[model samples]
Target: MEKVTREEEIDEIEKIRMTLGAHLEELRRRVVYSIIAIVLCFVFCWFFKVQILDIAKKPHRFAMGKAGLSSELQVLSYQEGFYAYMKLCFITSVFIAYPFVIYQIWQFVRAGLYKKEKKYILLFLPISYLAFVVGGVFGYFLLIPFGLQFLIGILGPGIQPIITMQQYVSFVFMLTVALGLVFQLPLVMLLLSKIGIVSPDKFIAWRKYAILVIFIIAAIVTPPDPFTQTMTAVPMIILYELGILIARPTKKGFILLGTAVGCGAIAVVGVYFYFTHRGGEINVSNPYGDIQILYPGDRGWKKVSGHMSFQKGITLKTGKGGRTVLSTKKGVNVGMDTNTEAHFFDSWKMQLKTGQILISMKESEIPLEVDTPNGRIRMNKGTLNIQAKDIVTIVTAVNGEATLLIEGEEKKLLEGRQHKMSIGGEPVDIGAIINWSEGIVTKSDEQK
Candidate 1:
């Protein structure tokens, strides 16, 4: 009898190996399918690459609208050009192929689950996908724009602001993926709960720890502004609470809807504030930096100092004082002083923080670039219309007849006939135009 039992045990072991082999084969097949699908999607995305990039730029576009401005931001590399589209394609493909990938994952594990539990795993596929996409949208739509605007607007005049596509794309990618994954907390916790691996009671008990984690996560994910970080943390905390609340309850699908509605309301308010206030952050990398204070009605410029590190874009060119123009992969803060002649530029960026940027152009021929049309340069004056992408050209006419040379055809924008008085010793707009790039800015009288 003992011999017979041993033989039977060996047979059972062999059968288990066979089952494992079958499952492994299925996993391999699924992986191949996923790879193929991703490749196909990426190729397809490459076709409509421009469109994808346009979508990625919407946040910046929205922020620029307040000043009736548009930017013709350029990418420096040839091979790495069209980077935004590449990022969009990659991200979109992951999402597009997720359902199939999840199905494959489920198939690999389903044999181990009892018939009763298999459906839950299958259902989780869509839930996880939806939650992530929603989170990504929320972040892109609400938080990123405001954070960018606040930081950029703070860098005021004597600095010609320039941003690269690489940094922007990376930012969008990180935020979208991070937020999408985070938003899946409830579903993930629910699954663990149903499996008896995690108890709702225990989760509630350890809520404080969770809050700390949320704060840390908020800091990691949001831009380095306390305001933006706090805003994100509050929502995440609220979401955690909602997850806890729902973790205990009956089969109420409406719970998610209610939670979503509340989240939506908060997001709406956040969006409104972001648009109404924040404009864009500045990237400054200057050694000999100075600030300027220009009032609506003043005479000359003053030199005030500033504190900025770098969000992005540092050149190799030595300053007149010979300083390194550093670039930031994340962003760094450096401290410097700026003189007062830069007030006009600074004030332009600062007006966004308070709401609208109001500066009377007076009787002068300043070059103006409008995003609404190509080569639409003008001697901008009289309550100049502003909107997202409205101002893309440079306004350059300290003297009479601001000649706009766009698209090979120079249009005499505003006839250069009058010189507007320089507002000297005007209070500097702290959160306005403070950036330092080579060439884009002519030396301010105050800097001299």
Candidate 2:
């Protein structure tokens, strides 16, 4: 009996070793397939390297333009361009081949999962890819442009920006990839809950800490500014909420929860739209030089300094070399430039009668409406510089998106772009008047 028992134990150990070996072999084969897919994608991307480079340079160009500098990137060394191209192509290839790689991963792991669990994994594969693409697009369209603009804008006047190709490529690639990976937050949370590693109740209890950690992660991943970090953190918070909603005990429960959330969201949007047409009071402070205020039905403009609150129909005018900052209860800031005159229709809406004003909506998500002689400027978030002249209004989207309504037609004004329209409400092209890349010099040019 002892001899038989010993033989049985040896046979069991051998079978275990054989199973492990087979799994390893399968993993190796999957890895090879993924590598082949990546290689093919790399070759395809390399063929369109120039077009890819152009697409990559758009944000950099916009940033430089906003900074009132040239948009050309430098090549510090001859090999720098080569390496940059290689890195760009490789990153692009990875994004293109990501789905196939995920499919291979699913194939390798499916054998270990039960039939029901395998369905979940398969369903997640495409969704995972979609989330990654959404993250990448968010970074490319909003975060990258605005972050670069803020960083460049802070360098101030007279300091020349010397960005190199290799450095820029590396920065862009790292940021894009990091955002793509981080956007898997909700899916990761759901997975943890499903595997019993974390419960939904635990996630709810840890909400405050999760928020703190989310902001910290945003700071690490984004440019070192409160504006950019907050911009990144807001979406992350929403994703966390989504994770909680999807972490129900059963699929049916999740579906019911999703339906409720969808209805809630629609109601929220309706409420927001209704509030957009309403008005509120605003606080004006930090007056420098000569600042005058005219209240509703006032006989004369009163010259005053210090904090003051104004209701609807109040007008504020600044004299020569005068400036002041306006703030709202919701944390919107608008800086009135020298010799400016603005009339308040509401807390979120103002009319720039003349001169210039700089609006910063970084802390506020509420939309601000500025009515000028030329057109109407509507911005929900970002920094905007508006100069109102006698016959024209010049609006520059310093780091956010705005819409310019000209004669009932709305044209979107994007970051780093300027829109100049005449009093007739016609969109006037000013490409001939403003040289966006003026006064910018490279290191080589500076040396010369």
Candidate 3:
């Protein structure tokens, strides 16, 4: 009997060892597949290095245009350009092969997860890829351009910009990779929430602290300027808020309330647009006090009162007690509150230099785009209330929907939701929308 028991114990040990060996083999296989995918992607990116380089150089060109300087990036060392090209190819390859790597990782991890959790693996994989791409685009298009311009501008006039190929490539790569990782904010929050590590309530409670930390991070990552720092922080804050919203426990009552509010707000905006068919011009229906308008070639701001035509490259400023409302031909309306500064870069682009502006527009062929220190906002048919204060920009979607492009990702802001983005860094949804148009320069929120 003793001999039989010992033999059985030996058999059980052998089985355990076999299971361990099997897991190791599976891991090795996944690693090999991931490596193969990366190598293939690397070769493809290397082949298109010239095109990639051109694309990367766009922001630099834009910055130079803004600064009124024209120069090509230099190469100090004999192989500097070659090394830079190789680095770019490798980075691009990683981005291209990221999805396959994620798949391999998911395959390895899926074994330990339950069937329900397995669904998340599939969802996360695509989202991960999308987030990375969005982040890369954000770095390439917005942040890098603005940052390079600002840095060049601060150097003052007559100082020609000279950048090394290696330096430029490294800068671009660091910004792209950092943003790509940062854009994973939502996914990380969702995963933690799913595992019961964090909840929506916890995120809400930590709001103020999070804002502080976000700014600190922005200052560290971005160039030492309020604009760049605010830009970076805005997107991060928005992402954090989105994470909270995603993690929040779903409630039928809350959804119903939000739906009701959204419908009401939409109806109000629709009615306002229907009655006032004024083409893109400032409406002085009830001007609070006096305001100033500065034309592109004007020497100084001119005091204005009541109903002015909206023109491209026009600057509007409101004094301590002044208020104004401007509208576009496409039924796009902008209401500037007291102590606000706004510049219409073009018909489609408006920059909120400082203070608050409420925008309401119906879905049309022409999209109204607003630029702030944080990022860019594109609206079609939506009522958006944005406030710029210090280093933060608060955006609340009163009705319809708007798209926020920051850090290479486009986030949809739906009605009945409030989002806050750091003018320097990230973005977050702060929960239910409030009455943000209480004391607007245009029509009151209740009237709207």
**What C-alpha RMSD separates each model from the true structure?**
18.8, 19.1, 25.4
Local distance difference test, candidate 2: 0.79
- Model 3 lowest lDDT segment of ten: 275-284
State the lDDT of candidate 3 residue by residue for 150-184, as single tens digits. Answer: 67767753355678988888887887887888889
Off by over 4 Å in 3: 1-18, 249-448
What tens-digit string does per-residue lDDT give for candidate 2 at 48-143?
Answer: 999999999888876665444566789989999999999999999999989889889987876555445666667777787889999999789777
Candidate No. with top lDDT: 2
TM-score of model number 1? 0.57
Per-residue lDDT tens digits for candidate 1, residues 182-276, read 88888877777877788888877888999899989988987877867766776676666666666687444356547755876787687676567
Error of 2 at 398 (Å): 36
- The model with the greater lDDT, 1 or 3, is 3
Model 3 clash count equals 37
User: Clashes in each model (backbone N, CA, C under 3 Å)?
Assistant: 59, 0, 37
Give per-model TM-scores: 0.57, 0.53, 0.52
> Weakest 10 consecutive residues, lDDT, candidate 2?
271-280
